[model samples]
Target: MLSVRSAAVRAQCPSCGTWSSRVQSSYRRTASDLPLSGRAASLAERVRRFHCDGAQRTRRIFAERHGEEILAPFARRTGRLEIVVHHLGLALGGGPGAGFARRLQVPVSNDTLIRVVRRRATAKAYAPPRAVGIDDFAFRRNCRYGTIVVDLENRGS
Candidate 1:
């Protein structure tokens, strides 16, 4: 296990975007990180909660926000580790990715990998098709027919 902590004494409010240093409380959050020395690693982070004194805002208290590139809010893994999992799931698929991760000293389940892939797929933005092509195919020599639509620009069907 690797211990870590945010060095910033102040954090910006997610609602009112005000920087605050008055700490109301602190807590520790543990998350999975990249492997170290060919072994799975975890990060124990010391997180701080601040009292949002913004009188105009509805939120009276909020947790400190870390850099998105470093660690996402309420995430179970570090950003870099999540990126590795994402690529592994995308390239090798769920079961294979999970197996490969185990070999690399990364602890992950096949279902988790599948979920990561699904999340990534939903998050990605696809460009609108500029042109499309349609065709009909027979599955059983005229007994069953199906229609197929293809994006001409992206070459996706």
Candidate 2:
């Protein structure tokens, strides 16, 4: 476990780009970072809530921009960790990715890895084909069937 205590006072508003020293509230959050020495490390990061004083934009309150560069929004693990996880998920499929992550001491589930890959893939812009071919495929050999839509123009996917 990685123990962290609060440091630094920040007053910058992310949305409006204004600065202030007024403190609305202070709190601490638990975060999971990258593995250290083949062991999982966690953090007790201190966070601060600030009242937005900027008049340019209209957000009443804003949280401190602490670790925003290092961590993804609402994410426990650091951005670097997530990047490593995403690469693992892409190289190895879900189950294998999870197993590999365990070997790397990340300790994440297959579902989590799958979700990570999905999120990263969805971030890119894509143009869907205008036409598609629809067919029914045997999802299970004589038990069930599912509809499959194939991109007609591309002939792939």
Candidate 3:
């Protein structure tokens, strides 16, 4: 089982540019991931509420970080599980992705995977391009070809 421990650390307040030690609060969250060898990987993180001594009178609760990882800010599974799900999602497609997760004893819905794929596709479609250059490529071997519009402003195709 994953357990969270409070540690002393300095954090910057988003409301004000004041740096101070974050105070621990009675808040905790645990996220589970796909099991490994009949055991599941879980993350236990502590949440803290901080008091800022800046000009603004505000208090903020910040999630503690473990090493190079940030928790609570975004929902995520374990590193290994994430890798497996990503690869399976890409290889098996969205429909089979959810099935793969079920086989692994991980709770994942098909709609979630579909939504993820759609969002990714939309993001890629509207991605910005760095350099813009026109190049001619054959659409079909020797049948059709057209000039591709390359956006040079953002380095995206």
Task: For each candidate, give its TM-score against the true structure.
Answer: 0.77, 0.69, 0.61
In model 2, what are the clashing residue pairs, if there are any? none
Model 2, runs deviating above 4 Å: 3-8, 67-69, 126-157
The local distance difference test score of model 1 is: 0.87
Q: Write candidate 3's Cα lDDT for 47-144 as tens digits.
A: 66666767765655543445423443565655445555556666687778888778777666777666555654675666556667999999999979
Q: Which candidate is the best by lDDT?
A: 1
- Could you arrange the candidates by TM-score from highest to lowest? 1, 2, 3
What lDDT does candidate 2 reach at residue 156?
Answer: 31
lDDT of 2 by residue, 31-132 (tens): 677888889887666667888889876876787755654654578777778888888888898999999999988968999889988987787556788998
C-alpha lDDT score of every prediction, in listed order = 0.87, 0.78, 0.64
Best by TM-score: 1
- Clashes found in each candidate (C-alpha, N, C closer than 3 A): 0, 0, 8
Give the Å shift of residue 34 in candidate 2: 1.2
Kindly report which residue stretches of model 1 are placed more than 4 angstroms away from their true locations once superposed.
127-157
